[model samples]
Target: MQSFRTELENPIVERDIIELEQKIRLFREGKIPDEKFRSLRLARGVYGQRQPGVQMVRIKLPYGKMTLAQWKRISDISDEFSTGNLHLTTRQDIQVHFVSLDRTPELWSQLEQDDITIREACGNTVRNITASDAAGIDPDEPFDVTPYADAAFRYFLRNPICQDMGRKFKMSFSSSDKDTAFAYMHDVGVIPKIQLIDGKEVRGFKVMIAGGLGAQPQLAKVAFEFLPADQLIPYIESVLRVFDRHGERSSRHKARMKFLVQKIGMEAFEELVKEEFTAVKNKVVPIDADAWIATEPSETPGALPAYTIENPQQFEQWKKTNVFEQKQAGFFGAYVRVLLGNISSDISRLLIEKLQPVIADDVRVTVNQGLLLKFIRGEHLAYVYSQLEAVGLAAPGFNSVADITACPGTDTCNLGISSSTGIAVALEQVIQEEYPGLIYNTDIKIKISGCMNSCGQHGMANIGFHGSSMKSKGKVLPALQVLLGGGTMGNGAGRVADKVLKVPSKRGPDVLRSVLNDYATNLQEGELFNDYYDRRGERYFYDLLKPLADLTTLQDEDFIDWGQANDFATAIGVGECAGVVIDLIATLLYEAEEKLLLATESITAGAYADAIYHAYSCFVQSAKALLLDDGVSCNTQISIINDFEKHFEETRRFPVSNFKDMVLEINKQEPSAAFAEQYFQQAKEFYKASQQYRANKTAQTVNA
Candidate 1:
């Protein structure tokens, strides 16, 4: 543990690692409550796995971009700490499983050597900021969104505002109107736009807000047709502040930003966001596009690399499906379809070794859990293919019907009910062997999640399935809730897949064969899959595929789940997806004191806006701590403020008369240094008073 302390270059990062190590030690000694410790570790990207006593450390890669050295460093870290297998996620993060909890700070320290991070990759804080893998190189893009995404990632990485929100926040930057990044399903989705103002072409963004995918999927509403690029960060900050203050907290299921927007209409949400503009650190945070340097090919354009095509047909197919012409002429963008997004450390190392010379250093982990290599010279396409093929990284049909996306269901996730990976592998086998030509078909997409949480983005897939279980003749069997008619409509609009039917997990292959065969046999020319499904209607597909759901026709093997050797039984553990909810009064006061410390630190650093927000958090946490001690339920920060007045102030238990007015000043006034200082003092006084009151009550109890 001391090794990482001296090795880390950044003082803040060093302190963070040290804190985590200390927290882990305290947790082992039962000094920190389980729920409180869970929340702290989750924000730092250390997650509890389905298998107890091990962790899954998610490495946050902003927009999935990683340099060659960073990629190699991750592989080395995986070899040393985990199972030597890197699991890429749908959110463009790489996760390594089965790591010892005690060794996580060391693992994170090693990753930081190459400028990599695991911070905020999971939990209630802002997860990894994702963008289209082709963001910079896409021909359809208005401008490169790489810098903007980078800016957002940097601004919010350890920002005080979103540290402990009711639920996690997600943001995405799409490359084009095609919405390759799935902006429509993120909390804050940004699509670049160019508007003419005073005969000048000015950069802007088409902003969407409060969209998310889970059991209940909501498409983000268009907040602005064109907001000046300079105002993007401020707008996002305002939204975060509003959400932190008023978002639902008591119910984990309804704690998402989308739910907050749904509870209070979009118009109201927008008004709240506008009200917080004064409190935002920057009124206009301009993004310098030129600051983000595009990765250039290291090799000078010269003679083509010597390579003999062993099979020209295979090479041609690979080229057609995996290669695309980038906006930069004479350079190609290549995709490598990592089956189930699981690539071994050895293969990853080999991939870097073989492709480093020919390709640019920029490698993007795609949103669909694949890899995108930018700036590949046309002359070296065959050589690139040869190298990838040799390493088993040359699977074709990247982002096509054949390239199925699936999450690790029963494999590692605690919330997993059935085997998403097993079913995905089975379905991919069906596509490759039976519907081989579907690799060229990009209209239809197949995604599967372990549960309805949509980690695999199943809610937006053209053909999606989420893991479930079905009862047949009093026996339980793994099932998949088949969903249909969902696809991106482009330009911040998309459809949520309708729950069509449920069938046995063993019938998953048959389900796909039926759907694809039926579509292929009776398809209209140039008709997309969703359009075809729409024309046929939901009932039509249900009737066509319902035969597989018949319990009477179930075979002996149907009782078993995919990738399992024995009979199926549901085994689920407590999910730490959003971290745990801590209701202990002692923990709340401790956290409130911690918030005051943060507020003081922010004041010292001259970050007035951050200090004010931290102070505001202190006020809320202090109020909530006292309110909970009185058996009052505190769901939202806003509710906590109101409930404190009702329970403590009204009853004359606490002396403060206008607690609401005092705390609401955060949104009422600009975050000036003077105001920040005043707010910090008020918050510190409130926290101290609450502590004394609690101490008096404890003394009275002892006397009684």
Candidate 2:
């Protein structure tokens, strides 16, 4: 590994890269524990993949907007360090997989040269803050939500409060009531709204909270029908504070904000959020839209070049499906559909070169894993189409059924059970070849995930499939859990797709054909897929597709998974979305000491809430370490306090009084300087005593 001491312009970012390099070096030298190193690397966007000795680097694209320069920079980085493929995610970020982990710091530094980032793109922190790709250009939008989304992304990027939370948090912003961003299915969903008060128009947001999709999907509750735009940041900060303190940490599945809100009703959650108001540093965060206003590129083609369309009908189809008339008169938003969200680095640079003439400088990444090119002239539509077609990116049906959304399942992800990409390709071919007319149908979305985790946003798809497997005669076979009747209901309401049935993965195309054929033959006029599904119910679809799931008709090739040469086998690896568990007592004690130091530093910086939380972590980690010494393994922080009270505090084996009360004091007391200092003292005393007690126990064990 090489040093990045002076390579980066931003000293802060340079230090971050350098620190990552140091950590990776330490991890390689066997100095740091695996679990601890995994957490650190994940926060920096270095993710371990299903394949050993390679990593997936997720690049955080705030609001999914990136300049041409940044895109080219990413392309260059991918070409040099990764597999020369850029995978756009459903969250509007770009991921490059199969990269050497030791080279990540260099890659991150190179990306930073063009103002791109990967920090906080993964792990137990706020993921990329996504918004409607057509935000500024949407004709139906009340106002652009880009500035507000950017504000949230900037505020929390390095905020101490969210550095190491119980689980990853997600947020989204929709430009209009159409809910193009699918704000209803996020941890914090905000839809832009305008309220007239005494003849004056005031900007606000319809806020939703605690919505998430995993193996289990939950809809977000309306936090406020109309929260003033200025209060958005403060409200989010408070909600995060509440979630960090009270959210589940033991079970990864139940650690999302959705579970916390479900466990405790919305009313109770709101009360807890209200309690965090005083601790939040900002009462109101005003967004200046002018600061982030879209502007044309400084250098553009002086004259439009003459071009002839070789395929006139295809170009027209591309325009019909891929082009959208922007709010600006005569301007258009062109969607470039990259199949499976995988674009080669060579094609990516060509796009930057070709589209520079007519398109605006602002290129937004659509949530459906496509590119949104803004500010194209009406006459230039055919030209843009030509340029894109030449580069093999002029695929019609940008958000239509043909453009299937999928994750890199077995290709790169650790949690993938089957080949999501392979299945997606087959389904897309089904739509393109058989159901050609459906290319213009944006109502039906087909999304796939390699696993039950909704990274591909399968839960929100009208027709969704997640990778799985089945057993027949002692052989494992690739399977997909088919889901139906779920999609955006508009106005911040959405449906989670119901798992209808499971079928062999190779039958994915057949499954689609059956569903579409059934819809085409038996559908009523003017009814959407969800309505049809509701009218018929789950059993109707199950019985209709039941014959496809028959194992008796299976062939020898059925045992083989997609995109593989060998027979199917469940090769699932431990997921690292949430950090791995560390059973080493020494690591816990070291982390506790580190937290205490962080608390002291935070107090000096006047971040009272941060300091208090650090102190709280110190207490919990130290106590948990001591409890582990007694063979009392606990999962959650709350449980650790309880068990410590029973096993140590009650027996008078450890020097403590009212253990629960002592640990829980963090929430009851105000986050003031005095309290922060006092909490720091308490945590220090507890850590010291716990270490001494552990030493005494070790001595006794040795004597015995």
If scored against the real structure, what TM-score would every candidate get?
A: 0.98, 0.95
Highest lDDT scorer = 1
Q: Residues 457-500, candidate 1: write the lDDT tens digits.
A: 99999999999999989999999999998889999999999999
Give the total clashing residue pairs for model 2.
0
Q: Residue 344 deviation, candidate 2, in Å?
A: 1.1
Model 2, 430-494: lDDT tens digits are 88888899998999999999999988889989999999999999899999999998899988999
Error of 2 at 70 (Å): 0.8
lDDT of 2 at 291: 74
Against the unseen true structure, what C-alpha lDDT does each candidate score? 0.91, 0.88
Q: Which stretches of candidate 1 lie over 4 Å from their true place?
A: 1-4, 301-308
The 10-residue segment of model 1 with minimum total lDDT is 1-10
